[model samples]
Target chain A: MMKYYYDLMSQPSRACYIFLKKNKIPFTPCPLRITKGEHRSEEYTKINPFQLVPAIEHNGFNLTESVAILRYLCREFPHVGEEWYPSDSKIQARIDEYMEWQHLNTRMQLAMYFQTKFIIPKMTGTEPDMKTVERSQDRMETILDQFEEIWLDNRPYVAGDKITVADIVAICELEQPSMAGYDVTEGRPKLAEYMKRVKKHLQPEYDEAFEQVYRVRGRFWGGENAPHSKL
Target chain B: MMKYYYDLMSQPSRACYIFLKKNKIPFTPCPLRITKGEHRSEEYTKINPFQLVPAIEHNGFNLTESVAILRYLCREFPHVGEEWYPSDSKIQARIDEYMEWQHLNTRMQLAMYFQTKFIIPKMTGTEPDMKTVERSQDRMETILDQFEEIWLDNRPYVAGDKITVADIVAICELEQPSMAGYDVTEGRPKLAEYMKRVKKHLQPEYDEAFEQVYRVRGRFWGGENAPHSKL
Candidate 1:
């Protein structure tokens, strides 16, 4: 039996969760709450020395990093839909290009913006640094523009017409800024439409994973249950 | 004909160059001098929208990002040795894991340190900022520790006993800081031995690609012929 360890709030964790759920890959869900430092426990360290979320164990083979896990699953289980990873070398290369590029670009910038705006502030009990926040926002803006002009470029999805794990990983990372009350899709129609398509394609799983994220957002950003909520 | 665009100065570019030469993969080399701003030329944008070094064009297909390019080459040329990428799903996953983890941790920190200590100072005609340089060095130290403790914990190679692309990519990234006069392998015996093995395995091509890099290092850092050299 495969065992997956993750927390929904972490972007890569959310990505893995959504991928596993959508693909219906059977595995034990081992959810770790990063907010409480559960990921740093000595026991979990044995599973993933990095102590990062979205790790898995199958037949005693442990793995970390979402990209590796996704690729491993696709290869290990041939039943994983071809549309998600695809078998064609060229098309798969396009998807691989996005996946590799996103680590330093899309994922890094958005996560930085979100962390500077919300997580850091909350953890430190201090206001966010305006200069650092603005710089990250600028970077995030540039990355979003690239997504629109370079990756999307009027295509229905990131790699091509069909949604791949690259799209899944991207959308999860993009969603991080929302918790900080930043709407990344506000000025970019291409990105906005692409996000909608990705969301619709993932269906209940998308909404399911994001529900926990948005609830945390609601409590922190005063969306609905601000007064009574305690995350 | 497959066209590979790269600059030996860039780590990923050197990795791709070495891989191609070592594997005997036929490619038309399109070397671009990043220092000359050749990569950012309008003509190059058609090949890679990001105007980045280490891209490839093959069969009317364009791909950027080193990891993608390497994987594509492995798949496209089935004759390429399996040890580089490994057809076995588990070993491949291990290679993929290191490849993915290095982007943000190993590559980012080492590149940040190199840029802060050497590249930025050269471009601006100013001394390196000690504070930022120290911070990046600290981060680089942590990443190196992880490399030794987590990845290379007794394994002859990064993924396993056999040399893989992951080791190639890692060694190239690790070499960047040397230009800034940082000896990353100084305190780590395992890393030093691992580096030696990777170099020996790749042989003359490793020495070939690095000759240009070492030349650049010597020119700036006062090696032989420093007075007359202009990079």
Candidate 2:
């Protein structure tokens, strides 16, 4: 059996969790409390020097990086269906394009949202810079616009009609801003509708896993930490 | 035949070039001069709105992002051999860990080198800030040290004894500092040896492609009438 080391609130961890559960892959969960700084402990650092979560240990081989783990899983369980990771050259390329592009665009943009919402408030003991937060929201909006126009177009999901890992990756990052109290769905109707479609496509097992994680977060924070609600 | 749009000086483009050549994959080379802002042109942006180079068009599929393209090629041409992309799950996961880790750690550090050695010099119209350059170099050294301690250890390459795309990705970024006139090989015998080994593995093709693009760069000026390097 494989062991998954992750924190539920982590965007990438959720993506990985959703991937594993959706694929019906079984693994022992080793949840870390990132907010409490458990990831920085010497014990955890030995597992991953980078100190980030969503790592895995299988048959004595330790691996980190959600994207890499996802790719590895795709190889291991090829029958999870082609939609998660399309075998078609063009579709794979599109997913790849998103994966690479999102590092700077989506990843960085979401960081701004996180910094403004959680990090700044927690660190400074003051309200976040609303101007910066607004700017980040605008930047996210621009990226989303591009996602809709270039990637989504008329398709029900990103990278064509099927729900690929690209959608999982994208939705997770988008969820960051939503968690930060911004209603990403309000202004972007197509994106909101697409999110609904993606949720519908998620397997019941995966959905249940996500719900379990969400309940834990909600109880911890005393608010609507549900996937769809603002964090 | 596939067509590759790239600027060899770019780190990611070099990764793609090295992989394509190493694997003996043939494609029409369409070079973009990043110094002249060719990548941002309307024509080029049509191909990749992100305005990054190393975009590829194969069998009517247009793809950008070096990592994605690398994976696609590995899959499409399985005969390229297992060393480049191992088939085993555990070994492959190790490779994934390095690939994902490099994006922020190694890649970001190397980009700082680029900023200090190239961008800053071009901007200030004088020698770059040596203090900043040294700091950036130190950052890169830290990453390289970790690369050896955590990832490389006693192994000949990143994944294992055999080199994979992870090595190619790692080395390409490391090469940027060297190309900009820093002797990265000094004081790090293991890294120096590894560089030699990587070069030796792909030298024939690497040198040939490098020479072709290296000479073309001499004709370039920063802007319409900006000063060019005399050498």
Candidate 3:
């Protein structure tokens, strides 16, 4: 049995969890309360020195890094093949390119925006800096333009027709911003349609996983619901 | 021949160049003068949207992101074999884990250090902030301690006894700070020995590739030599 440590609200952890469930892989879920700083504990550090969520421990082997864990899952489980991770070298390479590029591009832009604008400000009880938030939004806008022009260009997915792990990795980040009421695909028809397709592919599972994501939605929307640390 | 666009002084470019040469894979080196702003040209952006050096074009398929390019070449070439990228699933996963982890930890700390200390300050005509540089160094020190204690714990190579692409990627980044005269392995005997082994394995090929690396070494050491934009 493999021990998976993750939080439902964390994007990468959600991605890993969704992938495991989608593939029907048998594993024990070891949820970590990241907002509570449980991940920083010595017990969790032994599992992952970096103390980030979404680490895996199988027997004696321990692994961290979401992409690597997803890659490992795809290779380790026989059920997950072409559709989950295309066997074609060119397609795999395209997926690889997006995964690498996203770390600095989509992941940073979205995560930083949420952190600076929402998470940090809320946690610290400080006012959110609109200037900094706008800068983060501005950077995301540039990458979104590239995403439409280059990545999702007329294809059904980032790589090609079939949905690969790249789409899973990307959508997770792209949707994270929506938690703060910034629906990215709102203005662009092409991107809006693409988002629809992504949601359709992962549907019930996606909705189930991101339920906690939207729990934070009311925080920025100025509703009665107060944002929990996790929210 | 597959066209590999690179600048020798760039660490990622050097790693890709050396890997191609070592594997006896045929590739035409298409050098891009990054310091001259050639990479940002409209013509180059058509090939790589991010306007960065170390891109590749295989026939009509254009690719960016050095790690992805390396992964593609390893898959595309037969002569490279499992030793370059292990055949065992678990071993390959470990390498994948390292490659992914390095981007945020090892790569970020080192790159931020150089950018904040040398490149940005030089371009802006301002004194480098020792405070920020020390912060970057502090972060690197923590990771270096982890590198010795965790990754390189008595192992001959990063993953195990055999050298994988991860070593090439790491060694290239590890050597970059030397130009600015930060010998990371100075007091750490284990890491210093590990670096020696890495250099020895790569041998004459490593020395030849890093020729321009040492050429720029004089720049930060306060010698008479002027630092080129490429440096």
lDDT of each: 0.89, 0.76, 0.82
lDDT of 2 by residue, B1-231 (tens): 999999877888888988888777989989999889999999888788778888988887778888888888888788874768877877877877787778777788878887897677976899878898889888988887877677667889988889889888987777666545555666677877787787778778667656633453434333333221221
Clashing pairs in 2: none
Candidate 3 lDDT over residue span A130-206, tens digit each: 99999988988888777877898779799888888888888888888777667777566677777778878887788
- Candidate DockQ values, in order, are 0.91, 0.57, 0.73
lDDT, candidate 2, at B110: 77
Model 2 chain A scores worst on lDDT over the 10 consecutive residues at A222-231
Kindly report which residue stretches of model 3 are placed more than 4 angstroms away from their true locations once superposed: A222-231, B222-231
By lDDT, the candidates rank as: 1, 3, 2
Question: Candidate 3's residue-wise lDDT over B1-231, tens digit each?
Answer: 788888997888999888988887888888988889889889888889778879999988998888888888878885685778877888888888888888777777777787777777888999989998889888888887887788897687888888999999988988777766677776777877788888888877898889888766764664543332222
Question: Which structure is stronger by TM-score: 1 or 3?
Answer: 1
Off by over 4 Å in 2: A81-83, A129-141, A203-231, B124-139, B179-181, B212-231
Span of ten consecutive residues with least summed lDDT in model 3 chain A:
A222-231
Error of 3 at B133 (Å): 2.4
Q: How do these models rank on DockQ, best leading?
A: 1, 3, 2
